[model samples]
Each structure stands twice: as C-alpha cells, then as structure tokens.
Target chain A: MGFLEALNYPIYVAIFICVYSFLAIGLNVQWGYAGLFNAGVAGFFAVGAYTSAILTSPDVPGRLGGFGLPFIAGVAGAMLLSALVALPIGKICLRFRGDYLAIVTIGVAEAIRIFARSEEWITGSSRGIQNLPRPFGDLPYVYSQLAYLALVAAILLVVYLLVERQSASPWGRMMRAIRDNEVAAMAMGKDVPFRRLQAFVFGAALMGLGGALYAHLGRSITPEAIDPMIASFLIWIMVILGGSGNNRGVLAGVTIVWIIWTASEFVTDQLPMEYALQAKYGRIFLIGLMLQLVLRFRPNGIFPEFRPTQKDSRKPDKSDKA
Target chain B: MLDFINFYVVPGIVTGSIYAFAAIGITLVFSIMRHAHLAHGDMATMGAYIALAASTMLGLPVYFALLLAIPLTAALAVGTDKLFYEHLRKKPKILTTMSTLGTALMLRSIVQVVWGVGTTSYAKGITRPNDWFGLKIKTNELITLLALAVVVLGLAAFLNRTRWGKAMRAMSDNRDLALLCGIDNARVITLTWLIVGGLCAISGFFLGINTEIKSMMGWNIILPAFAGAILGGIGRIEGALVGGLMIGLVEELSVLFIPTEYKAVSAFAILLLVLLVRPRGLFNGKII
Candidate 1:
C-alpha cells in the first residue's frame, strides 16, 4: 500500500482516540474528582449523537430532521441536550449513594437505547439518522481523514486546556475534598449535592460533545454505534486505566486501550469465521480481566493522582507543642 | 378483565417471580457485602447456560440440570469474590462495585462465546396453557410460582431458624458489631454468596423456561430486578419479592396505557420515583 494509504488508517484511529478522550475526560470529572459512579455513559452519548444528527442531517421524510444546521450548532445542541437530560437525573440520583446513581444511569442509558430503537419519528428507529454533515467531506479520502483528525485533535487540545485549568482551580480542590470525605466537606460548607450535580452535568455535556464529534466523523448515527460495551464501559476503562483524576493520564489511557482494542480486531479478522467471533468475545473477556487486575494491583492506575503538598508553615511546630 | 388477568397478570406474576429470585440475590449481596453486585445478572446468565449444557450435553432432565447449576454457580460467585473482590475489601466499596461490572462483562462474554448468542430452550415445541378457572396458565408458569414459594419459605426458615443465617443477618445489620460478637465474617460472606448464587441460578432457569433463553435475557431483566430490589427494600428478601412482582405487573399492564415497545420504561420510571420519594424503600430498608 502507498504511504498515504497507510497514513490514512492511523489518521482514522487518531480521530477515534480523540473522540474517546472526550468521554474519558468527562468520566474523570465525575468518578475521579467527584466520586460519582455513572454507569450510563452510552445513554448520554446517544442523546448527544442523535441530537446532533437530527440537528445537522438533511431533511428525511417521516423522521425528525431538516434543520440543516451547521456542524457547530449540532455539536452545541448535543452538549445542551445531554446536559439537560443529566440535570434531572443528577438531581435525583446524586443525593443517594454512588451505587444508586450507577444503577439509575444504567437504566437511563438502556431507556435511551430503547427510545432510539423504537421511536422512529425521533431517531429513525434502529436505522438511525443518516447523511450527517462531515466537515470537508468532499475532500479526497486521505486528506479528508487527516483534516478530520486535525479538527478533533484541535478540539481535544482546547478541551484539555480548559479542563486542566478548571481542575487546578479551587473548584477542583473542593470536589476532591468532597470525594475524599463527604462529611468533612459538608461540614466545611461546600454545598455538596449542588457541587456534585455541577460535576455530573458538566461531565455529561463533554460526553455529548464527544458523541457529536463521532457522529459527524462517521457521517451517520446508528443505534448500533452506541452499545454500552463500547461507548460506556470502554470509556470507563480508559478513564480508570489512565488515572481518573489526571486528564493527561486519561488521554494516554485512551490512546493505549483504543490501540489495543482495534489492533486485536485486526488480528482476529485474519482468523477463521467461528473462531473470529469467539475471539471477539475473548477480547472483551481479556479487557474485563485486565480491569480486574488493574483494580486489584494498581487501583490508582498508571498515573496516580498527584497530591500537592501543603506548605511547611501550615504544619504544627514541635517546639510550640512542647 | 378475565383476558387481562390471563394474558397480563399471569405472565406478570411469572416474570415477577423470576425477578424476585434475582432481586433476592441482589438484596442478599447488598445487605451483606455493602456493595451492589453488578455481576448478579450475568452470573444468573451463566447459571442458565450451565443448566442448558447439563440438559443438552449430559442428557439430564431440566430440573436436574438446574440442580447441577445451582452449586456450580454458587461456587463461581464465591470464587469471584475470592479472586477479584477480596483484595479490595479495605478500599472504597465503589471499587468493588466497579470490579463487579468488569466481572459482569467477563461473564457475559463467556456466555456469548459458549452459547453463540442464539436463543435456545430445553424443548422445541411450545406447551399449551392449561385453563384454570378462566385463567390460562402455562405449566412452566405454574412451576415457577411453586418454585418461588418453595424457595421463599425455605429461605425464611433458614434465616429465622439457623445459626449461620442469623450470623449472616447480624453481619448485614452491623458488620463491626457482628465481628465484635465473634461471628466468622468470612464464613457468613461465603454463605451469603452460596445462597445468592443459587437463587440467581434459579431465577435464570425460570426466565429461560418462561421465555426463550438468549444471551441478553439476563441483562435485559437486570434493571427491573434492581428496581424490584430497591422498591421492596434492599436488605429485606420479602421486600424484593413484593417489589419484583409489582414491577412485573406494572411493566406488563403498562401495555394498556402505553405502547408495548415502552414497557421497559415503566421499571425505570418506578425506580426513579421510588428513589426520589422513598430511598429507604417500601419496607424501611437501609438508605445505602
């Protein structure tokens, strides 16, 4: 194959990496910083993807579309709608324990999947929304792939910088404080529930944006594309494996896990049909096994959370104590 | 009304019994271990598939196959705890919950690989429902209800009468206090898993008998099962039973008011409503 052809594959993979990074970063804000367990990442992701698809796709008879909005509006609408959905969910579930939140989120995601599959007028019902506007789609395949990669990468960088800034601020510190010791944080007058809701909604919006980016890249948004195994659990593994509290670590994790995942698919494809199908499941088994091992041995992940040391002046003096 | 009772309520009670079995397992684990056992559904799936193998491959009868599966699934559940959850005992409880999620994925993948993701049953031909006083009830449905009654009564007897069961209850009520009382925490935990796993297997088997056994069957029911568990009260087994039945009835009867396609939403809606209005559950279960 030609050099550009080889480059094309890498570019496509890179675009996906960027997309997954968005989800990982979003999850990190919830689980890593705020200690919120959200098992329904795919639900919010589907909401985002479908919202954008409906917003941007050309008119389709018997379905919700014909807006023909620009890609930016679609992306914005995706984030807005995802956040809106998260608001009530977070409000209700965030007050309870983390496990409750996790189960509720799973239910919500499943409900959303059902809605997308059955509500034909809204989501085109399993067939999904088609003909999404991909930026620079008319360009040649290789160039277009590269251009999309650049676009996603640029967006990822901007998101990374903004998130880093936010996490480094007092808000991040308060979130960590709440996560580590909820009672203590509550005592310190940190409106605990409200703050948690903020994190949950904010994280969901980012996930929605990631979905929009993915939908546009594929030029379609299908119900099949939003499976919980890939869209939710995979992103979870990325965040946890990368180091949940660390954005850079999560990005690195997205790169590593996505590569392993797709690379294994390539190897499995070369196998005979039945074995190949088994191999696909085997890969999931391995990933799940990998998670157990990771949680067991290295719970903090490859890059552990960095705790800033307090100044010595804040330490109690031995002489004064004596 | 008679048609609704036959078609909707009968099936509802049957499925509710299945969910009750699953919910009981979930409530047991939650009360004893203090974390949501996310793999409960997949463990049930594995149990159903194991019974499928026993009946199909080993030529055992369906009930005998289920008998074989119960202990095996219980052992698997206990082993899972030993391998994956043991080390995380001192860590945050949420970590163990996440580990179970991973376990869920692992168990499901294993099922998919072995079972080929296709629907299967013990027997190919469909059995006609026998009419009982104007109510149409399948033989399997009657079997499910009887089994549920037997399991519930047996469990109640065990919990109320046995020393080990009391110890398990003590641990659920107060872990540290139970430890102080010289109760063997490890043994109690093992016992809890044994019961939970066996119950999960029974539920999975009933679901298989009632409906087609597909790879995703357990997964699809897990949410409603959780709703049932929470609605009845997390630690209370009877609560799970009532909650499971209620959820099943609501889901089936929802077809009256809404499109059949949206039946699953009823469980989720009930879950949200219960969580919002009564986090402590119907029977005053622990908030956690």
Candidate 2:
C-alpha cells in the first residue's frame, strides 16, 4: 500500500476514536463526576443518529423525516432530542440508587433499539435511513476522510476543555460532594436529585452529539450501528479504564481500546473462515476479561481523580510549617 | 374463552413461571449482596445451554439434564463470586454491579462461541397440547408449573426451617447485625449463590424447553424478570413470583392490543409505573 493508502486507514480509525471520545467524556461526566450510572449510552446514541438522519436526509415519501435541514441543525436537534429523552428518565431513576438507574437505563436502551427496529415509519425498520448528507461529500475520498477527522477532533477538543472547566468549578465540586456522600451533600443543602438529573441529561446530550457525528460520517443511520456492545459497553470500558474523572485519561483510554478492538478484527480476518467467526467472539470475551482485570487491579483507573487538599477552617493550616 | 386461556393465559403462566425463577434469583442476589446481579440472566442462559449439552451429548433425559445443570450452575455462580466479586465485597456495591455487567457480556459471548448463536431446543419435534375437556395445555407447560411449585415449596421450607437459610436472611436484613451475631457472612453468601444459581438454571432450562434457546434469549427476558422483581418488591421471593406471573400475562395479553413486536414494552411500562408509584415495591421491600 502507498503512503496515502496507509494514511486512509489511520484517518478512519482516528475519526472513530474522536467519536468514541465524546461518549467516554459524556460517561465520565455522569459516572466520574457525579457518580451516576447511566447504562443506556446506546439509547441516547440511537436517538441522536436517527434524529440527525431524519433531519438531514432528502425527503422520503414513507418515512418520518427528510426535512433536508442543514447538518448543524441536525446535530443540534440530536442533542436537544436526546436531552429531552433523558430528562424524564433521569427524573424518575435518579431518585433511586445507582443500581436502579443502571437497570432502568439498560431497559430504556433496549426499548429504544426495539423502536428503531420496528418503527418503520420513523427509523426505516432496520433498513435504517440512508443517503444522509456528508459535510465534505464532494471532496476526494481521502481528503473527505481527513476533513471529517479534523472536524470531530476539533469538536472533541472543545468538549474536553469545556468539561474540564466545569469540573474545576464550584458546581463540579458540589457534584463530587453529592456523589461521594449524598446525605452529607444534602445536609450541606445541595439539591442532590436535581443535580444528578442535570449531570445525567448533560452527559446524554454529549452522547447524542457523538451519535450525530457518527451518522453523518457514515452518511446513514442504522439500528445495527447502535448495538450495546459497541455503542454502550465499549464506551463504558473506555471511561472506566481511562480514569473516569480525568478527561485526558479517558481520551487516552479511548485511543487504547479502539485500537485493540479494530486491530483485533483485522487479525481475526486473517484466520481461517470457520475460526474467524469464533475469534470475533473471543475478542469480546477479551474485552470483558479486560474490564475484570481493571476493576480488580486498578479500580480507580490509570489516572486517579485529582484531589486537592482541603484546608480545615477549624484548625490552623500545617502546610505553612512544612 | 378457551382460546384465550390456551393462547394467552396458559402460555403466560408458563413463561411467568420461567420469569419467576429468574426473578427469584435476582431478588435473592439483590437482597443478600446489596447489588443487582446484572449477570443473572446470562447465568441462566449458560445453565440452559449446559442442560442442552447434557441432554444432547451425555444422552440424559431432559429432567435428568436439568438435575445435572443445577449443581454445575450453582458452582459456576459461587465460583464467579469467589473470583470476581469477593474482594469488592467491602467496596461500593455499585462496583460489583458494574463488574457483573462485564460478566454478563463475557457469559453471553461464551455462549455464542460455544453454541454458535443459532437457536436450538432440547427435543426436535413439537409436542401437541393435550385436550382436557375444553382446555388445551401442553405437557411441558404442566411440567413447568409443577417444577415452579416444587422449587417454591422447597425454597420456603429451606428458608424457614434451616439455620443457614436463617443466617442468609439475617444478612439480608442487616449485615452488621448478622456479623455481630456471629453469623458466618461468607457461608451465608455462598448458600445464597447456591440457591440463586440453581434457580437460574431451572428458569433457563424451562425457558428453553417452552420456547427456543438462543444466545440473546436470556438477555431479552432479563428486562421482564427485573420488572417482576421490582414490582413484587425487590427482596420478597413471593413478590417475585407474583410479579413475574403478572408481567408474563400482561406481555402476552398486550399482543392483542398492540403490535406483537411491542410486547416487551409492557414490561418497560410496568417497570416505570412501579418505580414512579411504588419505589418500595408492592410488598414493601427495601429500596436499597
């Protein structure tokens, strides 16, 4: 393969890494910053992908949309619709403990998958939405790929900066406080449930945005693309492995995991046809085993949450003497 | 009326019995471990497949295959606890819950790799329902109900009559108090997993017998089973049974009013309604 040929694969992989970064960062906001377990990452992703596809694609006679709106509108609409969907779910499940939230989210994701599969008018009933516009469609294949990669990376950068800033602010501290000790936070007059809902909805919006990016890149939105194994659990492993609270750590995690996942597929394809299919499952088993190893050895992740020492108001500071 | 009973109600009861088996195991894990065992469904799937192997490979009868599956599945459950969940016992319960999700994925992938993902069943030919006066009931359906009854009664007797069972209950009620009372928490946990695992195997085995066993079958039923567990009041075994039956019936009956594809929605709807209206569940089980 020529230099450009090799570059094409890297660009493609990099674009996916950028998209997955959004999911990991979104999950980090929920699970890392706020200690909310939102397991339905795929659900939000599907909503976003479908919304964008419906908005941007040319009019289809039988289906719901084909409004032919601009790409920006579709992306924004994706975020809005995803947040709207998360609102009630977070409101209901957030009142309970994290485990309840996790189960509810899983169900919600499955329900969304069913809807995407069966609701022919809305989601095209497994055929999915095709002929969606790509931003640099007129460009050569390699250039378009590069452009998309740059675009997603830029968006990821912006999201990372904003999230980092938020995590550093007092609101972030309050969220951490609520997460670490709900009763204590409540005692200190933090609106625990409402704050949780805020984090959950916010994180869901990012996931939706990620989905929109993915849909537009692929120039189609399909139910299969939103499988829990890839869209949800993969993001989860990324977040948990990267160090949930650290934005940079999660990005690093995204890069590491996506490489392993994609690289393994290539390696498995080299195997005999019969064994290849089994190798695919073996890869998944490896991912699952990786999570167990991470949980057992480095529960806090690669870069643990940065904890600034709090000065006690009741006593004189000892740091000055040191 | 007979058609309704045969088509919806009878099938509902059979499936409900299956759900009850899974839900009971979930409730046991939830109450005893203070975390959702997210792998519970996949564990059931594993059990069902094991029974299939026993019957197909070992040439055992289906019931005898189930008997073999029960102890093996119980051991698998306890083994997972020892290998994956033991150290996390002192950590946050949510960590263990997250780990179980990974375990779920692992278990499902194992099933897919071993069984090759295509659907399979114990027996090849379909058994026609036996006519009883006006009512039609399959022999397997009858067997399912009988099995459910036996399991429930046996579990009730064990929980009420045995010291170890009482210790398990005490731990569920209050871990610190149970510990202070010199109850061996480890033994109680192991005993709980043994019961839960056996229940999982039975549920999976029956679900496969009634329907077909696919890799995704247990994952699909997991939502309804959870709905049943939550509706019945999380920690109550009887609540799980009732909830499971209700969910199964409602799901079956929903096909009459909505597209058959949307039957799963009934469980999701019920789960939301229960969570909104009765977070403590119908039997006043612990929310924690």
Per-candidate iRMS values, in order, are: 0.9, 0.9
The residue pairs in collision within model 2 are none
* Clash count, candidate 1: 0
- Cα-lDDT of candidate 2: 0.92
lDDT of 1 at B119: 92
A1-322: candidate 2 lDDT, tens digit per residue? 3777779989999999999898899999999999988888999999999999999999888899969999999999999999999999999999889999999999999999999999999999889999999988889899899888888888898999999999999989999999899999999999999999999999999999999999999999888999999899889889888888888889999999999899999999999999999999887788788889889998878977777653354246565666
- TM-score, candidate 1, is 0.97
Question: Which residue runs of candidate 1 sit more than 4 Å off their true CA positions?
Answer: A309-322
Clash totals for all models, in order?
A: 0, 0
| TM-score: model 2, chain A | 0.95
| lDDT per residue (tens digit) for residues B60-94 in model 1 | 99999999999999999999999999889888899
How accurate is chain B of model 2, given as a TM-score from 0 to 1?
A: 0.99
**Which residue runs does candidate 2 get wrong by more than 4 Å?**
A310-322
lDDT tens per residue, model 1, A157-237:
999999999999999999999999999999999999999999999999999999999999999989999999989998888
